[model samples]
Target: MTFFSCRPDTERRKVFHLLSFLFLAGFLLIQSFAAHAALVRIKDIADFEGVRTNQLIGYGLVVGLHGTGDKLTNVLFTRETLISMLNRLGVNIRDREIQLQTHDVAAVMVTADLPPFSHGGGRIDVTVSATGDATDLTGGTLLVTPLMAADGEIYAVAQGSLATNAFSARGAAASIVHNIPTNGHIANGAVVEREVPVDLANRKQMHLSLRNPDFTTAGRIAQAINGSLGSNIARVMDPRTIALDLTLRDSIPALSRIGDLMVEPDTLAKVIVDDASGTIVIGNDVRISTVAIAQGNLTIQVTETPMVSQPGPMSNGTTTVVPRTSINVNNGNNAKLGILRNGPALSDLVSGLNAMGVGPRDMISILQAIKADGALQADLEVR
Candidate 1:
């Protein structure tokens, strides 16, 4: 009787264990599907209008180089710039009849991006590149350079030691160099003296621009924004732009929420071919109609053999040389022709092409021919 009762309890336990395992497996499957369905966030595909970086440029001088700086004799602008800088610092170098020949000074162009909403006193990175004939900029210190925007107004000042991340070594006859030695970067090297006015909090409306313009993607983004936030808050302005109605909602928080919303972005089917590198990139949506393909190469080979004939014993006979030649040709008679049906998926298209036994360059030609025949359904871009 005890054995019978224990058997019932054991059966009940087995059923409960089986149900638990099944539930966990189903939960994991659902999670995986959701993860795959959510392709990308709104922020990854679009950007808010007016939220952009401004380019700033300035010309300056770098010093403290070990004979790798520009020669003042060859670069007259560097000489004039150095002399003018010295005069500004209360040093009367223009009056003196001194032929200034310094190899430790270099003329460089300073460039940086002034981020939107950047305030005064905020630090930003700067890039310094040689404008004159300077061999290397390693271990160089840039002077105080005033960075200006397109309006010719000074916005920031940069002055710091450069980090070239490069080195050069030379012997009497040979030399080895790494990365670009004439370009250097300075982290937090510039101090913003002025800021570009951008009032995001008080804006009544804003626009979102898609990185890759596509009609289907713009519509999906608008729908996702409207569905996640409120109805009619977002509308598609064009294939590349989506306008947001921000009169009722707070601009900052609304943008934050909208950016986090995820939607699967769509793209046009395209096939990119780089003939120089023999690279082929096919989009997942690329398709092809029914077509036949045959690829072969003609090979011709020539051989020449020379034989020497000598006079036998001391008989008066002149020695002679005979040349034999042979020629062969292969018309690729063993190559098999392949037929491809209309493919519904990228894998099917790839498999059909692979069946023809062709390389990337040959594949490129075949794709071009197919496109010309109106069989390839994707845009073929050659770079």
Candidate 2:
């Protein structure tokens, strides 16, 4: 014989709610773990070898300033450049004996970056910075200037109206300047005249270089690449270089496919401390052994209170000054000692230090002390 039982509606509702709450909590935990261990694309962490931008620089002139350009009497280079440019334009100013005086022109250095595989007639941006005592570059136009690479070859020509994005207002005794008035930028100011020859299609092999080198990361990258394409296609040459075999596949397509594949990268255990900013960054892999830490600083404060001593009404006492000072010394006797146990996670280390009520700057000192005592199992870099 069995007895039948029925629970109240309230009790049944409570049970259902408890089960829902548990399911929601578990789902959130799984999602957070997945996000923390997410894989990153190869293109974000590495770059193909021989693919880079070449720096281009040139000397030029900015004109049309409102009495804020370089003084030709003081800057001989500016005067000479102007004269040379005029000569090029068939003005022949070098033969004239009169002094050339103009406050509308300034000498500037033009710079640009020629991107990889840039073709002829493609436009690029250029930056112009004043090289003389010019006060401002606003409302100026950069003349035709030739951009040269490291090999002394002119690859581009720049000429555009400058956008300084700055302003200067002055009176007889005071002036206000916003941003940098002497540096300017021009959008699509230079046209490429030559292409940097790169024959990637006919290459037999290629290499991928990691921006931040690590042995574990290199092995993981090689493994990910090989698994995505085929066996033994990608090989880890060093901590920073990975060689990809291109004999069996098309170079371009294989590289494109490999770049799309994702990999989980590993980082070294490191702790970075910036003293100037009072910032401490702890890596997830940072570990600490069982250690005891106590952090405090000895501070001394001195206060001065000067008092004037006046003469009494009917006395011969002269007025004088008396100096009174109070000194206080704090040896940090109230600071509590903290015990950090050996832990496999970063949270334990952080929580242990936080329990002692120490700030970031104090934590930096504690971390350094722990490293000195051989208890911190990571690299400590202080800047």
Candidate 3:
């Protein structure tokens, strides 16, 4: 009879636990909703495999300079190239003593990025760097030069007025240095001479790559995609990849229509710390699992005092010197470890640490130690 009478109490306890769990879950749901409201497009997460820029570089001459060119002795290529060009121009000067002051010129290397899907005749910007000992390339212009890619193929032609923000002036035993002319830029200076083939619509399916791969994030991405385009349109390939099945879609337009759909990504909690830069970055999702943190500074000081004696006021003894030393060590007694029980969120951790007057750098080290002690649940990455 007693066993049967205890049923009501057991039933009441079970109901109370269920209600408490539901209340906590509902609170967490609301917090998660408010946290990630800025939705990013799926296209921003992935890079198309072959769609990239090709670095093109070429050696060229920057002409029309004003008394700022290479020192003939250090740069042999400049003199040799000038002689060859002059010879090609039918100026026959023998003896290789071609020591003409090409001060109105500077040797430069031109560089440009050949963007993927670049077509012939497309214009691009180019960077020109002085390879010679030119003081400045300011107010100068670059001669027409062909830029070549790694394959030795001429990809673009660069020519424009050089704009250098630096200059230099020199005199005997003294020199006035200004902006760095060793590097300059030309806006819209090169015309693309080659095309890179990229076909986005040719394939029946596509893959979305994540910038930072996380399994939880990938699942969320898949859910977001399927929520917008309906189920079976997107599937998770891995933590870093998602396959989109465009074959079963209505048409190309339908697939393209979903590309603009925005979805909020779920990222893992992490705190990135750079010790060399004294920087600390905390993510909103980071949480602390109930830990105590204390901070203190230990300082050691050493001082030296030197005393010189002059033979007791000219008693004719060689001056003797004596040294006095003092050393002190201080261990601060101000900070004490404080207990933080059942720590739930990142702000609580930050507040607790900041309340102790811990700087960002010190906080990073303390957090790392807490992580090592198994008190911090989030990842602490030191870069």
Candidate 4:
């Protein structure tokens, strides 16, 4: 993400000063981390094709609130819905002008993701977000609501007491805010009414994809699959994708064995920088080519004084005012450009940058410059 541009020679002085500040900043960042590192697993970084969850959503109403629900005026649907429910319960209320306790309820949209192959009667967590102008939903219970998918088909039924991380209290003149009001969640609120059709159990072959694309790792995975099953069933199509040949019955076990197989994968080191937040993140594999760096800064100070003098007790002297000004300029110590030779390790590069007395903001820019000049071997991403 970090893009670099050539700095004109005329602006070199200013740019170099800034670069020095950045070098120091980058150095401090590297010093904060421990030297040792943990190796990541190939399965941890990648996903397989057709193995994902589907989103399900439905418009629903949350009832049984403690007098802190959507207003009847803003949520006309709530009033209409309540009326319909009462009629079903053997109560006759034809007039819509009935004074309702809107302060104790809210209307919300419920959503949840259906994992692949989710069966009927299985429960899933649901998220509820108020769709009306309701102020709060504390101690509210969600009524029976049908969760639907984008296809307009009912997939699940959600009903449970909402768990809100936020609460609110209001007075005649003022109010207090604690947490988010518009949204809450209910765990295991939705029971799956339908199932997503997937062939995982009956499929002849299956594929395991890596979260991160790496040709080396993909090949290793194929090897593991073939070795585990004693047959060449798994093959790598690309760094991000793998194809498992299910032509034979034996291929089934080959695919299943892949889950437990271990494959060491190679990864490229990178450095990520966020200019807006002045953040710099360096990966373990980041390497820098040898280069010399020098840094310095200039400081300017200004002061002003205004003085007034009045005529003394006797002589008719006119009053006068005088202004005095003073200015000073201070240049920071000019550090010599230190040489960081090629084959420099991540630690050495950091140490050298720190020695130049750079700041975080400055280091961000310097890293960008170094990466652009091909002196840094790591990928530089800036946000």
User: Can you write out model 4's per-residue Cα lDDT over 141-195, one digit (the tens) per residue?
Assistant: 8888898888889999999998889878789999988988668899999999998
- lDDT head-to-head 2 vs 3, winner: 2
RMSD of each: 4.3, 4.4, 10.7, 16.8
* Model 1 root-mean-square deviation: 4.3
* Candidate 2 lDDT trough over 10 residues, lowest sum: 1-10
Candidate 2 wrongly placed segments (more than 4 Å): 1-37, 169-176, 304-326
Residue 364, model 1, lDDT? 94
Query: TM-score for all predictions?
Result: 0.85, 0.84, 0.74, 0.72
Best by TM-score: 1
lDDT against the true structure, each candidate: 0.94, 0.92, 0.79, 0.77
Per-residue lDDT over 32-73 for candidate 2, one digit per residue giving the tens place of the 0 to 100 score: 889856688898899998889999999999999999999999
Error of 3 at 97 (Å): 1.8
Q: Which stretches of candidate 3 lie over 4 Å from their true place?
A: 1-36, 64-68, 87-95, 100-105, 132-135, 165-181, 248-255, 301-329, 339-343
Ranking by lDDT: 1, 2, 3, 4
- Name every residue pair that clashes in candidate 1: none
- Across residues 316-383, which tens digit of lDDT does each residue of candidate 3 receive? 67988899899998897877887655556767767777777878878878888888988777788999
Look at candidate 1 and tell me the lDDT of residue 348.
91
Best-fitting candidate, scored by lDDT: 1
What TM value does model 3 have? 0.74
Q: For residues 86-171, could you state the per-residue lDDT of candidate 1 as single tens digits? A: 99998888988999878999999999999999999999999999999999999999999999999999999999999999999999
